[model samples]
Target: MSSEIAKYVSECFIKPKYEVQEAKQPYYLAPMDLGMLFAHYIQQGLLFAKPSNLGDEQFSIHKLLQSLKDSLSLTLVHFYPLAGQLTSLMDEAGQKCLVYVDCNKGPGARFIHATLDMTISDILLPTDVPEVVQSFFDHEGAVNYDGHYMSLLTIKVTELLDGVFIGCSMNHALGDGTSYWHFWNVWSEIHRAKAGESVPVSRMPIHNRWFPDGYGPAIYLPLIQPDDFISLQEKPDQLRVRIFHFSSDSIAKLKAKANEEHNHNNTSSEISSFQALSALYWRSIIRALNLAHDQVTNCRLTTNNRHRLNPPLPQEYFGNCIGALKTTTTVGELLEHNLGWAASLLHQSVTNYGDKVVRDFIHRWLHSPAVFKLDVLTDCYSVMMGSSPRFDMYGNEFGLGKAVAVRRGYANKFVGKVTSYPGVEGGGSVDLEICLPPHSMEALESDEDFMNVVSLPLKG
Candidate 1:
């Protein structure tokens, strides 16, 4: 190890607080597997052009590893109790929190070994330029966290591509997607500050104390068993993401038709757009599932748990504030009934999950030990839908023209998926992503009526 790297290690890892305890579940429960969760961290993730004047200025991987050991020393001081059995939620601690993977030798292959107390610095960010910064942020690691809290993977300058993705793999149970994003953003700010950058204020996240009660105008949900996790591994094939563009006019007409039948005067609402398209494609999926005669198949909608809380959870509060609502019907009913009826059902399901239901669900969830089974429910899952019109797919200014393709790689096998709403031009239209199995998708794609309904323009 280089002397500089060694010194960094000594300062970061050799002298920090530490904690060790048998992993256990806390009150905030989501569907989860009771096992150790894992994630990855990468050090020196970007490759940069060497300085022309300096013949061979390079970093030592061995010494970098030493620095990694030192940086991990900080985790001990910040450890917190694991909540909801989410391995991702465990506060940073020294015990079983870090590992090392040497992938320098080859691809489709790598070797891993545990480090005593791997500090965050052990995974160094490139000092060369912002280009390396973006690369390191983009494509450096993969899901390898299993049976451990965290692991660190270090690549030398020789191993990095023009861009690399480097981040931790955390159990969703530990935190929601919002929390995860917050964690990364904070980590970056802290690292930058340590490097003498003037980082501003850091915000502490609001800890979750609210609960979700499952009680409602009781709908039929197949009780899930403990073995459901094993069954989940064998999902159906229709889980891949497919992108489709709909003209503004088409969506508008669809919303008009939906509002007219459902008596919703406001045709230009996020809820309306989502409901219109979801109903159209869901009807198509029913056809594909060969359930044209059965009437119990349903579509699941994704609900943000933010406003469902008592007094409404703060938007800035980081954690999973998302839940799913199931809208059930048979192919016979959908084909037999008009789209308005379907839309009404969709509307009612969402409306029902308002503040009252949300607060109750959270409260009951806190006291209930009856594990909610996700397996039995997957057989007839809801079509998940949400909107993200402002996701900056092009904001990643890594010097290359903005990302030409921003794809969500989710093999949703046996799961229903929907996209965040991509609002219409002038923020008028609503665009969404739909992911379903091939056969179901083919049915939806071929439905002339469904297309006509969804294609109506914003003003139509």
Candidate 2:
């Protein structure tokens, strides 16, 4: 832990409130779950301003910690799979065929409590995100494959002088963003309820992982030793991150501009807010790079496949159900075209990736199960967008006041990975958290076409 972020106090494993045997056999992960094998853990945190009318000396961190840990135990009972560990499942030949979550008395989730010396404004000033935020999460650089031996869930409650940051680090292989937030919602609900009252959540984990049609639940990947993934992790880079806000009005204008310019061709459907904004960023980034006319560029998005499947998987499905969609083009093609053109490319790719496409990708992966590392990075200059704006990032109150802001801990960060969150002001607004090298970030900050639509002035 970084001393600048917090002073380490204590750590303990929080077990389920009651004994549970949800599955007699191991919870075998489906094909989609295995796709994230080498991806970094999903680390995010929420910031809450200190309780009003109370001084730092009056607030007791010990009491709040006890309450949160107690409710977390109850939450684990319902989300039992989170308390489990990912382990290898072997056949009679003693060869590793698949990895499954061992739910039978597995080690529990880790709870860490630390205290820092900073005010809430020190974090929410909208400058380049504070470096100390990375230290708020446990397993800061761990990959999903580490879930084989590491605890699948870790919550670090860092007490600040004028606020608190509740950070969560979950194995990306265990669930997608949807499932991760679902667990957070339940845990916060239990803690928010009246003392000793049983809580009934509107949504609960289905516990069963889904696979494509005609395929069994378990997909095998023989001999997945951790040593094989050491070289697969993201190499360190000199990067800077900043959250840029986009007002709802600006979003609407972008969508309108894209549609008016490109939709007249009658070649594609109307451009959405996400598609339009993504296009704007893509074009701005390409223009900033000053690439050659023939330089190849790609835009990758982690699109949710839940509603794209033919029959569609249930929204409540517990495991990952996402597919990565990539749009490829030359720098000249991307930069010479209007924003609408770039948006259409992204929109078309997303529109084309439907049921048959998803099933076909899964079928191909069934033959060779590999982690989502950098197998394709060498081919092109690329960027990625993830963490949807639809996630209810500010709604988890957890007995504290509503979150003043939401942030990502240092995990899974690469130079062009942009994370989108609903803006603090709500009303369909968005905040894009972009990570880029200092030189690229400098270019982006000065790019007039990109800065024109930003709702607020850039800081730092």
**What are the lDDT figures for the candidates, one per model?**
0.41, 0.82
Note the residue pairs that clash in candidate 2: none
lDDT of candidate 1 vs native? 0.41
The TM-score leader among the candidates is 2
Q: How well does candidate 1 match the true structure, expressed as C-alpha RMSD?
A: 12.4
> In model 1, which runs have C-alpha deviations exceeding 4 angstroms?
1-169, 180-198, 201-204, 208-228, 238-240, 247-250, 264-271, 380-382, 386-402, 421-433, 452-460
Candidate 2 residue lDDT tens string, 1-460: 2246677889999888887767446788888888788888899989887775445546667878998988998888888878888887677786656788887546689999998888777777736998889888988668888887888999999998888899999998889998888888888888888455457878877876677667777777867777877865654577788999999999999999999888767765789999999999888876766678798889988888889998887777888988779999999899888998899999889879999999889888887776656555423266788898898888898667788888988787776778888888788899999887788889999998999989972232
Work out the TM-score per prediction: 0.56, 0.94
Every model: Cα RMSD to truth:
12.4, 2.6
Candidate 1 lDDT score at position 266: 45
Predicted candidate 1 versus true structure: per-residue lDDT over 330-405, tens digit per residue: 7788767777678877877877777777656555553442333445445643455543443322222221222222
Residue 122 of model 1, lDDT score: 26
> Which stretches in model 2 have alpha-carbon errors above 4 Å?
1-3, 53-58, 92-95, 195-197, 233-235, 375-380, 457-460
